[model samples]
Target: MTEAAELPPAPQQAEAVFGDRFPEAVRYGELLADAGVRRGLIGPREVPRLWERHLLNCAVLSEAVPEGVSVCDVGSGAGLPGIPLALVRPDLRITLLEPLLRRTNFLEEVVELLGLDHVMVVRGRAEEVLGKLPPVHVVTARAVAPLDRLAGWGVPLLRPYGEMLALKGDTAEEELKGARAALSKLGVVESSVFHVGEGVVDPPSTVVRVEVGESPGGVRFAAKRAKAARTGRARRRR
Candidate 1:
């Protein structure tokens, strides 16, 4: 691990990105750089870029979301995008879904510190939490996985017309090209690349937006097989 970097107050430009939510956003950034790194949810080296690369990158995702709908942040490590979005959009209810206990503990602490009554943290994989969470209008993630696999996790969490807004960075188009077969199998419609926050952040945030259910069926992985595969992969990785 690199030398620990200090968590910063929201940079001056945070006001430009988050407006009145600047203070809370900064506080969240500080916690993420500090506790999040200490707990291994974030790397120590990422501290310097937390504000620009993580918080703002996630906050700007709000630009793609329609107003007044519930959202779930899939694999929400350190509450990127989810907590920031909630801070800015009181109209939306946000859930932070993560499978790891350490990440969830940190998220819960941050949620309470931020007084984010609207956000809840669930400690479970997306597959494990099905039927346990309310269907949300949008599902979101950042750096989670390839689109094909991410869609397998996210598409099932959406309401009939709900969408998955996966932040794919520079590979957005390439991932989209690769995910056609997966999206088709998953019953998604209108999958496209959306570049949000063009002026708010340099280079903008790239998102692959896909609506679930083309003909009354949403995308679903073979649950039992997926779970088994995930378990084997984890064991091997360990």
Candidate 2:
């Protein structure tokens, strides 16, 4: 059993949406409010509204997930969207992919404390871990990068035709429009904005959904890939 820490009361929004799952969700919230703050992953001021803003904001994205599939949360700092996702969807196999040791340590502990057997803590950036990581049906992220750059890192890690569901703020549509050129080259077949969690979370949650092509793959790092391509061309001529 996970030890409980002092926590703000679970937001009514959480109970309203999560229903019976509310208790377990609340436990996870307590864990985040304490450890996540002490570790600097969550700002101390966020503790009061953590349930509404952080946990619920992330959890509501579950509305976009198809049932029973593998999910990888890239750059899963403090396990946003990832940990909450695992807590809500016991069926999903979630990988919390984080490059930082301190954050991964917190993620691993949270998984252990919450007894989330379905969640895996992977410590590495998407660029370094893509080839080594198993291709998953969905790649989740929040505060990761702009649409174009995120595709560069995420598309290669997905199963062919899989999707990248990025939690963008209000700029989702604008970002999608701006990324068309990059998306074409990065194997993105479709890109759109989705508003999920209607009644559960106020204002709903905005997600940028990018679907990869049937044979999808892309550069791991933009600058590095460009340099490598130029070098190859120069070497061929020489």
Q: What do the candidate models score in CA lDDT, each in turn?
A: 0.83, 0.84
Best by TM-score: 1
Instruction: Give the per-residue lDDT of model 2 (tens digit) for 183-205.
Output: 88877888889898887777888
Against the hidden true structure, what lDDT does model 1 obtain?
0.83
User: Per-residue alpha-carbon lDDT of model 1 for 50-120, expressed as tens digits?
Assistant: 87788888888988889989999999988877988898788888999999888899999998988899888
- What residue pairs clash in candidate 1, if any at all? 186-219
Measured on C-alpha atoms, candidate 2 has an lDDT of: 0.84
Scored by lDDT, the top model is 2
Report backbone clashes per prediction: 1, 0
Error of 1 at 3 (Å): 5.4
> Cα RMSD to native, each candidate?
3.7, 4.6
Residue 96's lDDT in candidate 2: 95
Q: Candidate 2, TM-score vs. the true structure?
A: 0.88
| Residue ranges of candidate 1 with Cα displaced over 4 Å | 1-3, 214-216, 219-238
